[model samples]
Target: MATPEFVLSLREKIGHDPLPLVGVTAIVFRDEKVLIGRRADNGRWQPVSGIVDPGEEPADAVVRECREEAGVTVRATRLALVQQVPRITYANGDQVDYLDLVFRCDWVSGEPHPADGELTEVGFYGLGELTDVAHEHVRKIALAVAEDDPASFVGGR
Candidate 1:
């Protein structure tokens, strides 16, 4: 897993302190299957996700992440959810609070494989075959595929 240069530079000053960042999750679907990967760091199955580059569009980040992480090309069709994830304290003691933008992407081309070292395995899976995936990701998938789908804001009620 490569840390972006900007984040690395920030960590030089902040050390292990909490850093707020924007992230994107690509819930890319090909027919009845959804793409997922086994994370190299945690070994947990998850959708294609990555940190948004400074000044980059979130939807473009989704497409870039899918290609960079999973070796697939996708069209980001919709914004599915926006939520703030709990802070993550890395093994190196660096902490991050991520505002996650989940997108529903349609597969355009390319077969899934681990394009980078971030994921050990990558492929499409049926919704029912996600027993190994995190419950939060499963919920994202459901929300992304719902018939009455619209972008959901998790807070601000």
Candidate 2:
């Protein structure tokens, strides 16, 4: 399968007025290690995430992003958190305020690899050894996973 066109188009469309974008991310853990990817854009570690296509449910987007970014099939088990930031400024000078739906999921199949070119590295990190997480919200998701509170959205600092 090819990389979704929506991902490419959305990058150009960011910063447009009335930009209404929804995205999904996942916190996938096994044996006390959390799956994370080093973003090629920012070089910081973060969970699998991508923009939600039009008409796609956030849960579905989560699973799709997990597969696209990590090359792993996952089943979303629960709604972990909803991160709605009014404005997010990107390194490319494209600002996007998004409604981000985060989910807790279990890896169903496929070896973890950087399927999408956006990720530079991918691996499972122990809770105590995570370092330089890319975004505050990503860190929050990791903390929530460590606490075993799928609903928690607190930072790991």
Candidate 3:
């Protein structure tokens, strides 16, 4: 299945339109493992993330994305990082500039499974095993899980 037509239409309408899009991502860890999703579109591993809806807090969006992508309910502990990646080019040739807020979250309940169609697989992985992650920032977030600082956000280097 492809992305819903509504989303595609919206993307086309807003392509290069110069609007601020807010998104949220969650770094969920258990023991030494971090939850990651294999994106069906790119076949690459990344954290659970999605666009933040209007009027919703970034923390709420983080929890919602965790539940939707990883099939787990998580409680966001704190805002970990704010990333501003200017001009991201998508696979479809559209460009999006975004301000992303990442949160440090912990699983509160639910089982691990890929609930959203965007993810082909879902699992917890150790730092040593994450060789094929989609981006360096994601890898940094995974490494941050091992650090003593719980409030650190791994902004893009």
Candidate 4:
């Protein structure tokens, strides 16, 4: 997993302090299937996701992450969910709190494969038959699956 250059630069100044960042998840779909990948770092199955580069559109980040991590071409159809992820402390001692933007994407072309080393395996699975997936990711997939549904805002008022 390549750390974005901007993050590395920030780390130099912040050290291990908690940093707020924006991230995006691409819940790519094809018919009845959803794209999933086994992350190389944690071996957890998840939707293709990555940090939003500075000044990059969140939707564009979704497309880029899917291609770079899963070897698939996808069109981000809609924003599915917005939520604040719990703070995560990396093995390197960096802490981050991410504002996650989840997008529902339609597969345009290409078969799923681990194009980059971030994932060990990549493939599509039936939405109802998913296994080895974290509960949070499963929730994201569920919220994104219905095309007519409005995007979910996890917290409110």
List per-prediction Cα lDDT, in the order shown.
Answer: 0.94, 0.74, 0.74, 0.94
Which segments of model 4 are wrong by more than 4 Å? none
lDDT of 1 at 54: 96
In model 3, pairs of residues that clash are 80-153
For 1-157, candidate 3 gives per-residue lDDT tens digits of 3543544677778864544678787888777778888888878788888877767888998898888778998888767667675777766566666788877778788877978787999888886777787665564475446435554543545
List all candidate RMSDs to the true structure: 1.0, 4.4, 3.5, 0.8
Q: Residue 65 of candidate 4: its Cα lDDT? A: 95
Q: Candidate 2, residues 1-157: lDDT per residue as tens digits? A: 2435764576566534445578778888766777888888778788888888778888898888888888988888788777675686655555667777778887788878989787888977886666577567555565447435656543554
Higher-TM-score candidate of 2 and 4: 4
Error of 4 at 139 (Å): 0.6
- Evaluate model 1: give its TM-score: 0.97
What's each prediction's TM-score? 0.97, 0.79, 0.80, 0.98
Q: Considering lDDT, which of the candidate structures 3 and 4 is the better prediction for this target?
A: 4
Q: Is candidate 1 or candidate 3 better by TM-score?
A: 1
Task: Evaluate residue 89 in candidate 4 and report its C-alpha lDDT on the 0 to 100 scale.
Answer: 96
Model 1, span 1-157: residue lDDT tens: 8899999999999999999999999999999999999999989999999999999999999999999999999999999999999999988899999999999999999999999999999999999899999899998998899634789998798
**lDDT score of residue 8 within candidate 2:** 52
Task: Tell me how far the alpha carbon of residue 35 in candidate 1 is from the true structure, in angstroms, after superposition.
Answer: 0.2
Off-target runs (Cα >4 Å) in candidate 3 are 1-15, 142-157
User: For model 4, what is the alpha-carbon lDDT of residue 14?
Assistant: 98
Best candidate (score: TM-score)? 4
